[model samples]
Target chain A: MPAITFIHPDGKSDRVETSDGESAMQAATRHGLDGILAECGGNAMCATCHVYVDASWLARLPAMADDEDALLDGAAAERQPASRLSCQIVITPDLDGLVLKMPERQV
Target chain B: MSVSGSPVTGGPSAIPHLDVDPFAMNFFADPYPTHEVLREAGPVVYLDKWNVYGVARYAEVHAVLNDPATFCSSRGVGLSDFKKEKPWRPPSLILEADPPAHTRTRAVLSKVLSPTVMKQVRDRFTAAAEERVDLLLEKRSFDAIADLAEAYPLSIFPDALGLKPEGREHLIPYASVVFNAFGPPNQLRQEAIERSAPHQAYVAEQCQRQNLAPGGFGACIHARVDEGEITATEAPLLVRSLLSAGLDTTVDGIGAAVYCLARFPDQWQRLRGDLSLARNAFEEAVRFESPVQTFFRTTTRDVELSGATIGEGEKVLMFLAAANRDPRRWDKPDSYDITRRTSGHVGFGSGIHMCVGQLVARLEGEVMLTALAKRVARIEITGEPKRRFNNTLRGLDSLPVTITPA
Candidate 1:
């Protein structure tokens, strides 16, 4: 299992191993990461699972879908180019050291 | 205004092209026609200028609700242009996220609200609902929404959550405004804002840790805070979600159930003959007249729905009411028959994001309706009922009924 680290918006961080085929949101949730709220169960509809992917890893991820882009626009935290809805970002073996940051709020 | 350029494009047939404002409709005292037009206008019709899609059909609405991935809720479940205007508050901890995150939060809540845990409080809840219904039946003529529906949930929910009822009057107004904001910024939002202004501070105060009781849901959230699951500050917001989402929805649901049974004497008689129908009656009422009319979900990509290309980032509104009465899915969709086996209805939503507190709502409905079915032999309208104006909720402001006690 690959390791994933989530740095809370408040600068707090927790690292957990990602199960094969689990998305970043799932790993955070299984480990009980403080700030990630995937309210819609990984459907890109609710922006509650908003996260800022490390800029270095941005190019490696797939392009944001139209729906993900629209919902990201509604995230409670300021939207950044690195901001991606965690539900849309599926975890694959190619990306190893994934570091994501939580948003100030999910609503 | 032509339907193409007007706000009421999918409005009732009588005024198809005109802008139909609910508040204005409230004055006329009936919006059933408007509901019909919206239902007839295809599954995803443009609500004129408001870039949101209106889903009035039964099948599609339930499909969208169940598939959170297709109709995502993360962009704040409300109608606010979440991209531009900041929400009055944060997204709901449980209702507004997709799975994995939604799964985690829901797990915590599901554990808390499990049937087993609810059983602990079931007797108390049943007793409270029964007592309120008993008291109301004694009066013979009462506003069903206010006296029974509103009274029962308001009294019991706050107690279960462990909050003091010193200034709980604001619960309905606050929740009404909160749910209204989910729709377009129309007259309904303006009114809710005005009505909620006075009670903002008290509501905020209730969210604080000091105000919560030790053994209730609110305090349970506080305990989660101590365990570092959620911040202490975020605890109140979680409590706020339960309080806001839980109250009026159930109240309206039960009220609608009673109203339907009263309107259809045969169903009422069937219920009277078989007291066991109380449970089915609640679900039947939800199917006949859904408490939640519509909710919006943003598509994750340029998804294809019913052969229509839902552009990425576009908002698609699911009309649960229309879906409940979808002619294709339900036989005699409009009729309120308690005996109908309505298993797959979207009244409590579908999928992982379905209502977490549904059991609580069901219990509330069952207790009240059972008491009424047992005590009343006949019920009829005493006067014209007043419908409450809300963007997302469908309920009466006042339901006047004359109960002929058995």
Candidate 2:
């Protein structure tokens, strides 16, 4: 299993192995990570799973879909060019070591 | 903010036997205590100030909303006495009309906004939720209402209905005033009117056929007209229902859920431990703190409730949030425990007018909560929670939380 590390808001980090085809959210949820909430179940309907894409890995991921971009406008945190809805970003072996900064709130 | 010291003899403090105002301050900010008074006073209390009939108990309130024939909506659902008040615009064709006519219009809407059609849009919905959550987890300190609550619904609902991006910010305030206007005219109503001005034209323009997405709900309303179910003119009002009914209700509903979870950490742990509890949490939150607090229905003829006479054309206000917390119906009425079976509570208005957009709300909740439960080991409050200042919705204005990973 490819390993993914999630850094918490408190400067703590936890590592979870990801299934090759699972999105970062699915991987976190499957492993019981506390930082990601895939509300709308990865449907791009609710912005509960907003994440700041790591700058270095930003170009490696696919472009944000129109609906995803529109939803980013409503996220709890400010939108950044690196901002990508985790549900839209799938984790592959090509995307190993992907790091995402979680926002403070997704209420 | 406290009315406790006011005079009780026929003054504003007195809970009038009958014909109280729906838009009154007592009823708007915190109607739960007044609901209890009404249920105790009689099944029907005439609010002398607003001249509207008040039904505080669960059974009577449910009966009024369920029975459209006796308690008609054709005259309009608001206290405006449509004949007297010049509505900023016509009433919601779906919310303001009675059955047979309402049935026909709802049928047209039911056909277009059907579950079968909504299923196709599920992926988009989930993706939107996933992205917002991911981003929020990064910043870690946000006003849940302004950032997530209002933003999420506004982002997804308009696009789902194919609304134009230009001047779409006014949709929530516009719908808020529309829902508020259902009560009597007061400071809240006046505030709503002033707040609603700039957004009125944008909302009206969105209703036009040319502005709608080719196959969106807006387009579907026009299609219903082509099918002869309704006149071309009724399409905008029907689409307006989607815009009005779909937005704040969900945000508030979801906000209530977040508030409950934060208020009760144990329940939050249970949900994370068992992903299946996500759906239960949503229903429990609605029962605990209903979003749409009270909606009125007018009686067509005299009827007795709790030995009180309810005359025809009288307004019956259903206290959904109160009934959800009614001691007569619930055990430990105020507790926010998700483990308890909490389905019967009428958070979504009951009967024919029971919220049609409920599934959408639930789906949004389940997706987000389940995902959150997966990542965070514990969700604890970082600061005091705040509530939104809306008369109809009982929701958190801010929920400061700290998500700790397992």
Best by lDDT: 1
Q: Candidate 1 lDDT, tens digit per residue, B275-379?
A: 867877888898778888777888878876665556777777677776778888788887888766555577777767777777677777777777888888998
Error of 1 at B360 (Å): 0.7
Q: How does residue B87 of candidate 2 score in lDDT?
A: 69
Question: What total of clashing residue pairs does each candidate reach?
Answer: 28, 65
TM-score of each: 0.73, 0.73
Model 2 reproduces what portion of true contacts?
Answer: 0.00
lDDT of 2 by residue, B1-406 (tens): 2222122364333434544444465555566666566666655566666677766666677667667788777666667666556765667777777767777877776656544555566678778877777776776666666767677777687887888888787787777887777666767777888778677778878988999998887898888888888998888878878877788888888888877887788898789779877866987888888888787777778876655666776766677777777777678978988866564468877666767666578777777677667766766678877655564666666777766655
lDDT of each: 0.74, 0.72
List candidate 2 segments past 4 Å from native: A1-107, B1-31
* Model 1: per-residue Cα lDDT at residue B282: 89
Return the interface RMSD of model 2.
11.3
